[model samples]
Target chain A: MGREIKLALVYRDMWQSSGKYLPRVDQLVRVAEPIVEMGCFARVETNGGGFEQINLLFGENPNVSVRKWTQAFNDAGIQTQMLERGLNALRMSPVPADVRKMMFKLKKIQGTDISRSFDGLNNPVNLANSFKFAKEGGMIAQGALSITYSPVRSIIMSIWRINILN
Target chain B: MAGIGRPVSIGKMVKGIRERHPDIIIQYHGHSTPGFSVASSLEAARNGADIIDVGMEPLSWGTGHADLLTIHEMLRDAGFSVPDINTKAYMHVRSLTQEFVDDFLGYYINPKNRYMNSLLIGPGLPGGMMGSLMADLENNVKSVNKWLVKRDKEPITQEQLLLQLFDEVKHAWPKLGYPPLVTPFSQYVKNVSLMNAIQLIKGKERWSMIDENTWGMILGRSGQLPGELGEEIMNLAKAQEREFFTGTPQDLYPNQLDEFRQKMKDKGWDVGQDEEELFEYAMHPQQYEDYKSGKAKERFLEDLEKRKAAQQGLTSVAMPQTSNSESNVMPQSMTIDVNGEKFKVQVAYGDAVEEAKAEASKEEPKPTSSGELEEITAPLEGKFYLTKDSSEIGIKVGDKISEGDTIAYIESMKVINAVAADKSGEVVEIVARHGDDIEEDDVILLLK
Candidate 1:
């Protein structure tokens, strides 16, 4: 048999693409249940990437939302995932190392199986802490390579080195 | 991810990295800000990028990242091995996501943001700022419309204003040393540019509408800009100087975990081992406090509806009157006609004693020619401040001031507007006190 390729669906984009603000928990649950039952995907990118901000902004409990989604996905026999912005973790800016670690731990306990980590600047130094926390929390750690174009040859070379090291 | 639009450079860099680090796994994350992220992602993939980040269709273009459907099709067409994705199941997911989108659009849709724009490439607005920019633009347009109506002038189209604002942002970026357009920094740049554009259109002086946050960013408090700011910008920063940090911005933030925990505990929050709740409180102190106290959700929903109605040019009501004297005092009644639709708004004031006391505390009464004293009123509703520097006591009683001299500042809509003296006179009584919230047409001071 040919090599079977695994597909991880980023369902967060589905809501984001709609160019709308945060979707209500009930709305998310209704949409997520059917997709979770599909069973064809390797994992579903179901949380993080501003969902926490959305929850806070709309006065919703993020913990409850995460737990509900995780339980729903777990029941459907599918793993859940999140995109962790390196130092940012879940906040607007970088948090303390302890805070970031706590975030990973909480997500894992709440049922996030995979954590895709990426730095905005493509700096390996930034991604290191996230990778450590994700692994320590027993979640799949997927490192992301941030691509950008610059006319400066040295900057481009440094980016290449960072990518290689990651 | 940052800088995801330079396809050729990223491609070359990726190829070079792949040649030496053959064992390394590479995943591409690109943002579609400059309308080149998809091509850049493909370029990286062809150069041995093992994974490429993409969003689902409908959320996948314009300031969003690359589209997964487009990528999947392209990769398959190029004879590359791909996943056996359940198409039928994916469609179902799309529909479900669409329902969420529909609900969101009902409240927050900005018609201007519904299409892609070529102008964004020059200003390089981050994907994250699209919604905020649209919202700000809409609000600015409404303000401009009201101002124009008051002056018996024709209001400019929102599109024209947006284009002009874009041009201003592009102009301001270089002035601020072209800092990477991302969160916090992006918001700062957009705000500064928006204010600059609005001020220019309103025939106000430059930096007249610069806010505290933007001032902080320029002074290197938020973080270092990519390069040195212009001499003009720096001079302005000097005038409104505050203690600025040279190190990482986040280091300046005091640890608040213990303080938050104590407060939450006092509120009877049984947060034992629930790190998530703690994190919530830590991330957004005020919002989380309101939420836990059961006062945020309802207000948020009500505000959302009001905002949506305002966007639709329909009748929108303001927040209910409260007895808190600290709150900004709004007008008791006002009549506004929009497109021939008149709105009669009735505002209820709080306790008269508290209101009078708050006003009196800010300004001390001084005797003058009772009929000769000219009362200078506030031009807008905002937080009033006596001086940018706290150490220096601002204009006091009997101080001589010249016309056009800025005696105070009012912060409104995130912009700090300078309150200038309309006529030269000795200060008789300062009515609007420092840090006191004031309304439009409120007596700021009396001079003779």
Candidate 2:
């Protein structure tokens, strides 16, 4: 409980941020207490405007498995359907037709990985939005954001100087 | 002697039951009657009934029982608890034909559509008004919570506070005599006013005091729903219309109201007008009242028993073997003065509508307050069905049937939900259009 190693996590708003609408975020947030109390920190790495890919920077537990996090969120209906394109990376399924249609009209800037439901309260974005951002085909821009997810400790610690792409 | 014997006119079987068991607790079961009739459950309290029952039909579990508002009032008035468990499985069966109400009412009238009756007929736990309100609010919140779960959206400020406010208002309304039917419609309207405020929050639409709740729905009907409720109806209806009243949700709910509406709307015709009226009709006072607390129903039973004994003695002494003819009986019986004028009509009590009708035509007599009078009414809608022979030993032309049988039933929603004799007695005169709505409460048929 002391000054836990701090990690800065980032994600986009799936619904409405300031004055625009995006897509409905159906994926929920699951918590693995091993590292962070909430769960692994998932962020969308965008290329230019449209989404490119999503990276799950681990929390306190650097070796916390991807299968474990995805399965955990899936059971809670946070991360519905996902296509695992990598060990630390994942591209989620597209939004449902009904939801996508509504969000399409409602979204002002056509966003990627922005959680609009209550799940976003825990983190900045929900699991569903993260998957959707990658599902729409966003790529991992130059260097990957570095972070260490600790499942047991339940605290996500950021790592620097190790940009994989760079 | 008062004209009393009539089918569907059981003056307090509740009283009958309570007298048999003084310490017994009365229980209300699930019913199809609309909200106002459910409020009539207040009679249970007046007569000393106990415990009321209900289920979550549609809008939301534990929140959408058609009679929820009135049921809550009945609970408040009697100071009893509302039911918590559904004990019986219930689904809101809706219609979607061009005539919305026609389909809805038609389905309700059908015995087959009723899937939520006669379960858990035995004794169960008792509850109070707070529990009822709590169950309603908690269950509704749960449903809303489920819908709001995945949104990653910001929590609308003060949702908990707003819900608390709504619960308080709902609790207090019953003290005002169960809200007079039109009130919930009005209250919903007011709440929707706040619903518009949800728009001010992030991720919600911006609504004004003026865009008419979101367009493409009826509003501001003079007598139908209060104008105050117009906005709320607009607000909620806009959403529900998309979900249930007009949309195609068959893939999700095949036998639901949404599916029905989808089927009917496919015709590209409009029958929404009558559908609304049918909604009103379903809310009529039901066959029985909710059992109240204490012992009013007990005392009421004592009074009814005494009244029955006194009337019984008088009848036996005067006209023991009364003929089934209009002219064979006395003509001086005074019935209750409904509203203003003394409605002098003979009384006939019977289980069968036909037997009562026959006795009404035969031995029934004119009600002159001399224990000999009856109210007259049409037998059916088609052609006035009457006895061909004038010399029949039953009721004469001038006699009336104050209570024993059904006067007539104009068939509409398939079968006969007849307008039976309020009181069976003699026939006086019938006043009604060949094709007109049955005006029973007004006594459009003035029996002499």
DockQ of predicted candidate 2? 0.01
TM-score against native, each model: 0.72, 0.17
Give the per-residue lDDT digits (tens) of candidate 1, residues B54-133: 66655666555666678777767756666655678778767766665555444665543444565676667765457556
* lDDT over C-alpha atoms for residue A90 of model 2: 17
lDDT of 2 by residue, B54-116 (tens): 322221111112233345444555556443322221111111111322322222121112222
Which DockQ values do the candidates obtain, in the order shown? 0.29, 0.01
**Clash pairs, model 1 backbone:** A17-B58, A17-B59, A148-B3
Q: In the order shown, what is each candidate's alpha-carbon RMSD?
A: 10.4, 31.8
What CAPRI-style quality would you assign to candidate 1? acceptable
